[model samples]
Target: MSLRTFKMVIAIVIGGFLIAGIYISVLVVERQGALRQISLYNPAWEAGQAASEFIRLEQRLSELGRPGSTVDRNEVELRYDILVGRAQILTEGRFQGLLERNPEHGATLRELQDRLAAIQPLVGELDRNPAAARQALDILRPLEGKLAQLASAAHNHGAALVQKDQQELVRLHWLFSGIAVSLILIGVVLILLLDRHNRLLTRAHQELHVLAHQDALTGLPNRVVLRERLEQGLAGLRAKGPSLAVAYLDLDHFKDVNDSFGHETGDELLKAVAERLRDCIPVDEGHTKNLISRFGGDEFAILQTGIRRPEESAALAARIVEALRAPFSVNGQEIFIGTSIGIALAQGGVTSSQILKHADMALYHAKADGRGTFRFFEPAMDEQLHARRLLEADLRKAMANGEFELHYQPQINLKANEITGFETLLRWHHPERGPIPPSEFIPVAEDTGLLSTLGEWILEQACREAAGWPRNIHVAVNLSPVQFRSRGLVQSVSRALAVSGLAPERLELEITESVLLQDNEATLSMLHQLRRLGVRIAMDDFGTGYSSLSYLRSFPFDKIKIDQSFVREMSQRADCAAIVQSVASLGANLGMPTVAEGIETEDQLRRIEAAGCTDAQGYYFGRPRPARDLVHTLAALRQPTEVA
Candidate 1:
């Protein structure tokens, strides 16, 4: 019940009790009044005492009438006085009312008073005159029956009053009994109401506790409960013989799911994943020591307790990985997803936070290695993660400090044997570490969500620098997958071209196949928007991804750059050469320029040019140089080649 309703019931119960008590008090007071009236004045007892006194006085007078009697005159006078008092009592107060109500009783009372008055003087002179005693007896003897009749009448009236009083007493008794019953019923109702209120409070408290410690979406233990369980397990690790394993599980590409589908569908998919995770562990019989919790979003944590070895945790992780591999049907769509797990074994001297951190680091490595896999936490991973965090922190500062610069690598047209354009490459120079390789800091920038900002800076800077170059040469800039995910990507590109006053056709934006892997419609739409800007688009690092050929069909491109790995091994590996030639032939047929990257020698260049490659960009032609040196490099490249 609501608090207001509960309070109202209590108020009603108290009011009932108060009303019952008040009525009971009134009944008790009335009963007491009736009892006091009946006990204080009893007409039947008064009449009997008066009659006995009359008899005693008569006998004493008879003794005085005898010759030489032993009866004392003073005693006879005392009897006379006592009889007078009794007659007075019978005619007063309640008795008077009783007698006056009956004509016969009233007349008898008058006659008795007259008789007593007439014998008052005769009693004292009884010893002196025997005739006086004889006269008294004659006067009193006629009134005996009258006195008896008066007594009988008083007795009948008293009996009637007692009967009426008895009825009133019975009524009072029933009234008191009824009030008592009412009080008991009220007490019962109050008890029942109070019990129900308590039960409601208890249920509300339980629900609050659940809401505090349980995940609302998945109904799993939340992070708060997870931390508690992990702490408890860690504390008992030394006392118990078995080991503890904390596994950090993250749904791979879960953000993509949320983006592609709606958040509601993503929520359903998370619930399904939680169910699958629960099914993967053994929790029946005596195996109740394990705990699985949702750490919010697409992240979950599992605690395996009382395990014999690390292998058990590994097996559990493997089971979870396998269980999640199956397609989940959410909102009538079969969505295929995967998980990356990181496991940390608990030992002496390790805190819960440390273990969880280690597990998270391992999870990062799992995702880095590729999703749908698991990895055990290693000491080396901690160092690596620490370094990565430091790098990410420094990367942010580097962007603000203007410590990065760009170099231009020339893309050669084999037919013209001249420089066509320079690919814009980013180079970072940290204050403390000097030059940091792109391989090391690029992933950190992407993971740290700084790539979009950095990519914008690169695009504007490259366009600004290329605007000063010869009007015939264009500039190519590489686009990270992270940049395409940004809603402002097309705007950033347009802003760059507008600010630099560079020709749209002279700005080439290069992207890898990974950019098309996310939100196909959005990606294609963004690509079309960029295409409408009159800028050239090239597929960079072509043939590096599984869906590169499909991506080529998905979007038309101005050029295709053959990945360096294939070009590097083309001479040694015939298949590599054949694959490069096939891509070149395909590009030619589609009227798209194909640039072979990483060409270092004449033999590699000759092979690519003869195999229908239109362009080449490698160290053999020119290494990437800064814009200051690029002017001279371009001037040197424009020089005609001398025949041997």
Candidate 2:
């Protein structure tokens, strides 16, 4: 039963109990009042009976006082005394009992007691003289009148009590009837409300069940519901020998979408993608099914049964990718999202999980091959996925294990041939994988969100190591695009400077053009924040990306490093020399220091120095080395130079 139904039933039961209590209370009050009235009237009824008996005895005594009658005075006196004593006893017992129970009747009972006491004296007087019998008769006659009046009052009082008791009975019946009617009305109302509430509860429960099985954002079947559907598809494939295909779809660059736009727009884009995927798959003829579900954030899966061939599944996957390639307009921006689809065919006793894994592997390949594409699963993909997973796991533990180290490449003053600073390069020495190059692991770290921690570690280590170096040379560290986009990048830099006791003016953060391609405001804001910290900002790999001049004008960078590609071809190509010379002249005009990278020979260094480049770094000066090796090299360079 639903919670609402249970509550409704409890409410109805409580209402019934309340009505019953009210009815019982009313009955008890009426019954108690009737009992009190009966107690009051009983005394009056007993007094009336005693008074009538006294009148009858007095009349007998008057008849026996005639001259013709022989009278026994002692017997008459004894009988009269007996009558008076009986009357006294009855008056004191029953009337006093009534007065005790009903104090409101105390005055009437006392008056009756006084009258009975007067009758006792009169009876004693009659017993004393038979001649006084006539006088007594006369007194007894008026006494009889008074006794009759008392009897009449007693009868009236008894009648009044009976009338009161009848009224009380009527009131009790009315009260009980009203309570019964109220209880019936309440029961009916409760039953009606409970029935309505139960219906509403049932509807709500059904809706909740539907919602539970569905994705709240996209209205697609959720992971749990999709898993059940996939299992059923697998069962059918196993029993009927039909081919089933599962495709895992992942949105490429979805994080960029969420980062550039807000999450609300990202959610809208996901819902739009889900609708497109659902529309792409046609329903099967009869028993076979095509089911679409949202696996998780920007990840979706589809299960298609009764495929005659693997190529059909590939076609379906392609259609899903093509559908997602359409631009989604959300929040007044035309957002383009690409999807990579992975297809796995059901055969060779593939379980649900294995099929899903194969599809995911294909998706990974699709994404790696460039998004907006699809790939069919191959067995060897499992090896690549395993290796990737292992690499990710090791990367997570690399920082804590102290397996990472920095190498410094000295930047030189091209004209003076003096070392200006060193660029810090990160390297990981894995125990099992030997030395892992930055090219291989840096991208992985960026993709896996390990770059933030790795970047901070390198910064802190470089700052600390540079603090111990000679005061003339500055230390430069490369900031990955991931780290630059991090929320704590500025704070991390500030903390590194404070902790290492390294002056901010001596530290330079090298950032690529990709970091500036995001929100220009945020990027500029972060750049301005770092600039305010008194650290030199160098545009690394300059002229390699679009908007080289625009970037220079947007933010005031202290230095611009000419990419090695342009520097390497300066000896062979005149165009490379002209480009370097133009960039150097532009830097000089803008008051920004220009450094040419990858200067190998004295001739190339002279050419760059003649081009007005202030700084240069390459093998010509010194190769990247560890801190100890760089220290020895710095010490050697500080000695007197020997001209060859």
Candidate 3:
């Protein structure tokens, strides 16, 4: 039965038991009440008491009848009153009902009452006349035999009533005993049912536990099982001489397969991958000492034990990678996919969780170095990961702590020899570590999803600060590629302009070619939307990507900022100078001004200017400074000083 049905059955059984118990209790209460009513007045006892009282009264009257017998009148009166009281008791209440049931007993009691009533008048006169006692004695003497007979009949009736009650009590006792036995039998049946239910529950729990630990699609052990084996393997390594390794593998570009073909093909491919992974292990050591587990969604883990050398684990990883490189036929279609593996070898102090994390870190680096390869976890990777986490944590709190500041680097117009605008650069001054470079924290912000909030703040702050600047100069803020992929990029830019009351034309948004690399159409559409908002768009870090020129042709940017790397080496490298001249010429032909960045020295500045660059931004102009320091810095820059 289903669990709900089983529960309902148990509930019904318990309710039946409760009802039966209550019924039995009610039976017991009714039986006790009947017995109590029967016990309230014993017919035999009443009859016997009446007979005794009469005999005493008779004997007292006989004494008074004897000549010169000294009997206290009060004693005689008390005996008389007691006899009358007993007779009255027999004729009233429960006794009266019993007397009515037996007509002989009722008639005898009435006759005795009539005789006592007749002697009562003589007994009262006995105090005044001695002869009255004899008369009273004569009347009471005949009542003795009648009262004895009445008592004997009452005794017989009481015996019959008691025997009937005893028989009924015997029947009730048997009934109760049967009920008790039935209850015990019901309890046994309930216990057996409960035992059966418990067994079913236990079996179901075991099945559920297996399902919890096993991957449904691959039917292989999942991460939970992998972690368990890793713990066991690590324990064995600590106690024994051989070491173990955990390799975390992630399918590279698996999402493309799902998108291109379908998820069904992807699932079949994963199942096929699972089979190949099993084959990749040595036939003798399959799943006994080493375990392979799926970590869900294009990720899997392998635990290798009894390793004498690191090369052994490396060989296994290589075998798996090589095995997966061959295309698999899924749904009659040839599909090619590769895996990236990160291996972490067991050590004295390394735990299962830490080793797993280390492997994941290695996998990240492997993917970074280009996928379809494997890497070992190194100490430096752990250190760098730890530092990045610390920086991310600090970056989250930096906004609320008011530690973020906007620094604007003046973009110099080479033709006018005057300042054109400033590029809004974000700077973070950690309370303890001092200023953290944007290169260090920016990626952390992107990874932690703090970039949206940070990006919005940057846009607003840059616009607000630039709004206070001289109207002719504009402020340029570089947008992260992640910000473009995320929603609300357009809304954030619009809000920053609106909230700061800055003209959209004065706000220049810069993006690199990387933004267009992921979603080319979407990025261009976003650029168009930003352009419609009356803002100037620029391509920052120009000439960094192979498709930078094509991206410029796709969108009409107001300005192009030549990458600092090219400008820095333009003086030393002929190719760098030619590229700079070419980008400047290209920008001029497009009617877009090209700003040469990293112009530190006069010779580099002269080369870019000679190359027909429109604007230059670097140390040769001024270092990026806070908005508050810009006015004084600008005035100082306008005053020419002799070169040292």
Candidate 4:
């Protein structure tokens, strides 16, 4: 109940008590007055009866004394006795106290006594003579008139007192009734107020619940609420075989928006996007169930239910992408954002965590392909992701346990058939798996963010291994794009060179095209820092990416290694040979030496040399081998070589 209601109820109860108190007081006062009046009336009536009886006794005596009449003494005595009894009866009972208390009733009792004394004298005179009796009778008549007048006055006064008491009693009754009515009205008012208060409290509670579950910015369900809903949907799906779909949506380039504009603008853009998503989902009572939620930051999740097939989820994913493709207006600025959606559907044997993981894996694939796309979950994708996770765990242990080893494949100067350098490769020897290939684990290391440690270790190991080799032979180690983008890349390389006691001129770092495609300032700064430290930078796998001639001119590179794909295709495709030749000519013009990789035959080696490639590395020269074997190969290169 509300305060108003409580107050009103209290007021009504108090009013009732007040009215009851007044009525009780009135009843007590009125009853007391009536009792007093009745007491006075009884006394006055007794006095009048006594006086009338005395007058009657004297008259009877006078009648007996009349001429020639005989008086009966016994009859007169009996009549007097009866009159006394009547007077006693009038004075006795409940009203006797009023006669004793009232001065007027006391005086009236004395007057009655005086009148009876005078009547006694009259009775004696009547007994003596007839004339005397007649005179006594006449006097008795006047006394009787005076007594009647006094009795009538007393009776009238008693009647007036009784009337006054009756009036007070009636007024008391009305007052009590009025009080009761007022109390009833107050009670009614109190009930209404209490009811209103209760409703208000109920509404406030509901509003509080809504606010707790909803996002303050977008008025959509928040992450906590969304997770709860997802769990409930998943539980239902577990019981009955209904397909449940979850799409993890991330706004592409959201960081760019934050970098370009302020966070305020980014927030506005997110709210707008949330509204668009809410509007895009269809509401159907029968077929489809959809709920959009803000999953914090620029990420959102959509729970789609009742999907019959995987393609339906894919279609929903596409629709989400389309919905977010439109530009949003934030603070008068037009901001465009694309979305990458990862969708996972619940089949029979999937937990919520596994489903979310699959969705994240699909999200990874979507981002890998490009932004503004959506992908469905695949079981093999989950296996691959799990493998990467396992590799990351093992990589951490590998660094601690010294399980990483370096192998070098010699890159030969094809024209002289002389060893120029060895390309460093890292191999992981897992205690359980024995040997994990670089092709399978390198990408995993990069994705798992273990490349920073792994890359530096390889650099140090390779530089130390090459320090013992001939002075002309250099060591080349591959750098992942993730490692190249790291802020500590230059410092790490400088430290490795220092620790190994290897000439920085002989320590070559091989980077792929992906590294050059990163942020210009950071990548360029890193490259320049490496050059300043006397470390050679080579562009590896040149033909596979957006490798332009302009990059060669813009950035100083020591060499350009043709990708193995083009090198292997040279014998079958004339275009491959011509492209390789063109790249080598371009490298020569730019003063950057060219290295052809994957040279398997003399024909491929001849084509590379004819194309003016300076260095070659493939199975034809030597496959990647341990340092001991590579040292022997290097020592054999020191001997005079026979031309092919």
* Candidate 3 Cα misplacement greater than 4 A, ranges: 1-340, 343-385, 632-635, 638-644
Q: What is the TM-score of each candidate against the true structure?
A: 0.56, 0.45, 0.46, 0.48
Q: Tens-digit lDDT track for model 3 on 284-341?
A: 4623367889989999988888775565677788898899999999998998999999
Clash pairs for candidate 3:
none
lDDT of residue 411 for candidate 4: 91
Candidate 1: 10-residue stretch with minimal lDDT: 635-644
Highest-scoring model, TM-score: 1
| TM match of model 2 to true structure | 0.45
Q: Report clash pairs, candidate 1.
A: none
lDDT of 1 by residue, 282-337 (tens): 56313336788999889999888787545567778888898998899999999999
**By TM-score, how accurate is candidate 1?**
0.56
TM-score of 3: 0.46
Please, what are the lDDT tens digits per residue for candidate 2 over residues 56-122?
5666666666778665455556656665665565456545644465454455434544554555555
RMSD of 1: 30.2
Residue pairs with clashing backbones, model 4: none
* Alpha carbon lDDT of each predicted model: 0.86, 0.79, 0.85, 0.76
Residue 332's lDDT within candidate 4 is 88
Q: What value does the lDDT take at residue 211 in candidate 3?
A: 95
Residue-level lDDT of model 4, residues 52-134, one tens digit each, is: 78677675666664477566545555555666575556446744554555566545545545544455554455435456545
Q: Candidate 3, 137: how far from true, in Å?
A: 99
